[model samples]
Target: MMTTAAPFRPGDATPTATIRTRFPALRREHRGRPVAYFDGPGGTQVPELVARAVADYLIHHNANTHWRYPTSEETDRLLAQAREAVADLLGAEPGEIVFGANMTTLAFHLGRALGRRWGPGDELVVTELDHHANVAPWRALERERGVTVRSVPLDLETGELDWAALEAALSPRTRLLAIGAASNALGTVSDVGRACALARAAGALSFVDAVHYAPHAVVDVRAIGCDFLACSAYKFYGPHVGVLYGRRDRVEALDAPKLAPAPETAPERLETGTLNHEGIVGAAAAVEFLASLAGGAGGPRRERLGRTFAALHERGQALVQRLWDGLGGIRGVTRYGPPPGRPRTPTVSFTVAGRSSDKVAVALADEAVFVSNGDFYATTVVERLGLASEGLVRAGCACYTTEEEVDRLIEAVGRVAPT
Candidate 1:
């Protein structure tokens, strides 16, 4: 018989009190009020352990790789360990993981490298719901390598992709399919498995942008069957670092541009120049922090992480539902994206009828309820919604987010909603 997955109940495995204490930033106050970070979609607050790991790396193990010195050797070992840690989180092999400055930079680097193999007849498929980081890099190939970038339309009202349009875009000429696992702007989760499967049938390689999805769900590279996937460390409770996971054979075959003397390997071949060694070390610590949320006792790191994310996802869904329902009840407040029961992240975007998004954001900030405003680098989504000029105010929930905090945000937005 198939075994049931480990149980990860909210109160049993990861209580709010136990989880909140781990983040040092939660102690911070804004204008005498304790800060509630509802801006996790932009970047998450780092935990003490992750910060300590960064500092420890810089203080004791700071050096270049492949040297005779002790620090250099330690640096090499730390990097390997970091790779393994990230690999475990993604359910991928260590060699398949590549480190870079951030997801955008890595995407550009990969796009340029991949562009080398294609010419005028090649096409790339992208969706309107994706963040610009996923859209812009492939679009660049159109100008540089005569690539035709085809876009899949989004259902603006539902905040979901048009699957029919997606299928129509994936012709045999489609060289690569670039899609986001979740919409950072609308919180809509796409069917990445379906997208990847369709791309495979069309003989097209698939690249999944999982930056927003990583903190909210479990990622299995093998299960998704994507050729490549990318996410940012800062999007989770880690330092500012970018991670890319390419399939072993695909990564090994890429003609990545690197220094002549650099180590020529699957991951290192894609990674150029000296990396953010401290940040990489802290990124691993962040993954460990997530694993620890499920108590870290019974199983391996990956198993623990699976349990932890399951619990976090359940908690986040509850909080997001409260926020969504609360916002919907307020006067003159127009909420965007899918409703509470839909497949989505713990992110909500909305606009006050008479208030610009920036004005609402500033008003909320005065009450120490921090949130993000504007397109959030999701320009296409805003333009498609016809709110390009005003954009949308976004509030996202993190692991430490409390029900009380969600109530406060709802109360604050109610106060700012146009009469």
Candidate 2:
């Protein structure tokens, strides 16, 4: 169904010096060689610490919470620590964080619970640029709650959100505004602060999916002023886990469907049943690993966490810029989002004319460079761009990505381009 693009080789060069001094898990061997992962939008490879924590949680503390036994108490304590870690990352109260299988599950649960409050003619705005994790749940909510779903359009040519269009979509009845921190399809980081402001002015709850953006950008729910935000730890070098950060008041206000008998926790109410405790522990470990990579704070716990997040932002921006520059110079390639030298994070999406995206992905894989080649669950954006049927290649970067990896991917892209 597709033709392969040209082939390119990754020439040998001394790797970037500014590499992670740690991350043995990421430096994993495949066929006796170091692996390179540019498919961060899909999932990030975790660090050894994260893996160790997961294994440790399972082997050493294999018990549920709240039991009178020592193991159960320990499990509860570890989880409490994890909640605090997540809260520190989002700059929110630990009680404000909710755990679930992944972002989609949390969004669906939150959407449905919040949907109970909506009625006919009420409105919600979902951006075309968001992954379905953020879009579908709201749409289901609209159908169930008699609310109207409004879609914010985009400038397809540049893969940028049409801010004016988004403003027009807002109204007094907009009960919720669903947006993504970054486009998993186009790598376009939305103006979450601006969107949140508009939603607040309309008295609507603003929920953002930072899943794709988390590895490449910094997230602070307080800074964005969002009512709720969800992201997957797996997308940021942890286990396959989802985390939700809710404004303390907003989370407390919503009565998510749960075992009513269960004690009311801002997060626990929404968390519902027993969860993947091991994964939660792993997620916390991943955050710790990233915080170390983030630098600027080898000091206090909370202060170091904040410093680490900011540092990731700076480093991610630099790596992404190099990736953009490398991809921009290639012929027949049309890039999406923030252009080559913009302040956007390191995830880059683009299409090679005349070659199907699936084929392009394979071509790159042949050169040992991995990338995603589909709607990437960012259905709305693709449908809006009329590329729903023909997705593009997405080569994203995480905190651990190196300049050599970027160069190898760029060179591979040039090879994958079919004439």
Candidate 3:
């Protein structure tokens, strides 16, 4: 009786077009070459669907929400659509989804709100694998509110979160645990399910940063049982925006220092001032773009999620494995995270032994291969691995990336490896 699930095929036309079709800008070639985007960890290249949604919002529904005019009513409708779309994307309730400018700002806002609850002697358990956005807030709380910020070390060899360190770090005084669902630098997907359970047992709330994880796979906050989750739209092939999901009760109870006239709603209260109606509308379209990749609909919720994600996952694993194997075969590339054919996203970071990360980035750029270099805002990881001064070069793949693209990158990296 389920009508939402869609059967997935390896090479369905609809999904293939959704994966390959690009807007004019995204398809624009510089010097007669397509820009191969391996910078997905930072953000994704938007499709025509998302671009059209943004334009449609600005042209047709330009007014702010809840106003009296027709434009305002349309804007309100768009807002509702945005909420529903984002909620469905993360398997959350519409009332639980809150909009923000970006994940870093949202995390800070949420942290400040949560920080109010913890005073002197209260502790926050954080990982060395998290971005500075997740680290600095708790450290600030420690300095200002007399709380203790404890660091949970990582297993550098495996590029994984150290559970023993995390378990021992938590105590009755622990108030929070901020962990990334996947390492932005290393692409090591952590066990948020276990982390959430541990947080609950330790009488603490868990915040999961899914900004990196959202694009590669499906996110079910309820399944993971985390307290707060944040991810960016740009990272997921949408416009530049962020989504924050909070349990209704917890969001309602946050003593956020907001305007006197702020709406007393679970989501609206946390949303603060005016939102990016256009970006949000575009985010809805982005979700549509992803769902469209699920083939046609006629199955159960679990079945649908499973079907679509299986295709995406297989594609991702293949591309990642190809890149890993290709890089490994060549000399001087010390790649991080799970090995080739491992259960991880296709985001890879590595050092050239003889070449600087900046040099590798520059060499790739010359060939119209766009990749990133440096910590990627995952400051704690870079510092932990002595890659802070000059970060490891990163070449990340998306659902849109092809086998041909990975081969090109490997060939280019090999040629540029200090030869």
RMSD of each: 2.0, 8.5, 2.3
Compared with the true structure, model 1 gives a TM-score of: 0.98
- Candidate 3 deviant stretches above 4 angstroms: 1-18, 23-26, 298-306
Report, for every candidate in turn, its global Cα lDDT versus the true structure.
Answer: 0.94, 0.80, 0.84
Best by lDDT: 1
The true-versus-predicted C-alpha distance at residue 54 of model 3, in Å, is 0.4
| TM-score, every prediction | 0.98, 0.91, 0.95
For residue 223, model 1's alpha carbon misses the true position, in angstroms, by 0.7
Pairs of colliding residues, candidate 3: none
Cα lDDT tens digits, model 1, 1-419, are 89885565555566888889998899988889998889999999999999999999999999999999999999999999999999999999999999999999999999999999998999999999999999999999999999999999999879999999999999999999999999899999998999999999999999999999999999999999999999999999999999999998998888888899887878899999999999999999999999889863568999888888888899989999999999999999989999989999999999999999999999999889999999999899999999999999999999999999999999999999877
What number of clashing residue pairs does each candidate have, in the order they appear? Answer: 0, 1, 0
Candidate 3 per-residue lDDT, tens place, 1-419, comes to 86653445755524544568654445767557888889999888888889999998898779987879999999988888888888888899999999999988898898888888889889998889888877887788877788988998878888888899999999989999988898889888888989999999999999999999888888999999999999999988899999999999999999886898879889999987999989999998888777767666545443454456678877888888888889988787888877755457789999888677898899898888889998888887888888877788998888688788889899989898755
**Of the candidates shown, which would achieve the greatest TM-score relative to the real structure?**
1
**Best of the two (1, 3) by TM-score:** 1
**Which of the two candidates, 2 or 3, achieves a greater lDDT against the reference?**
3
Inter-residue clash pairs, candidate 1: none
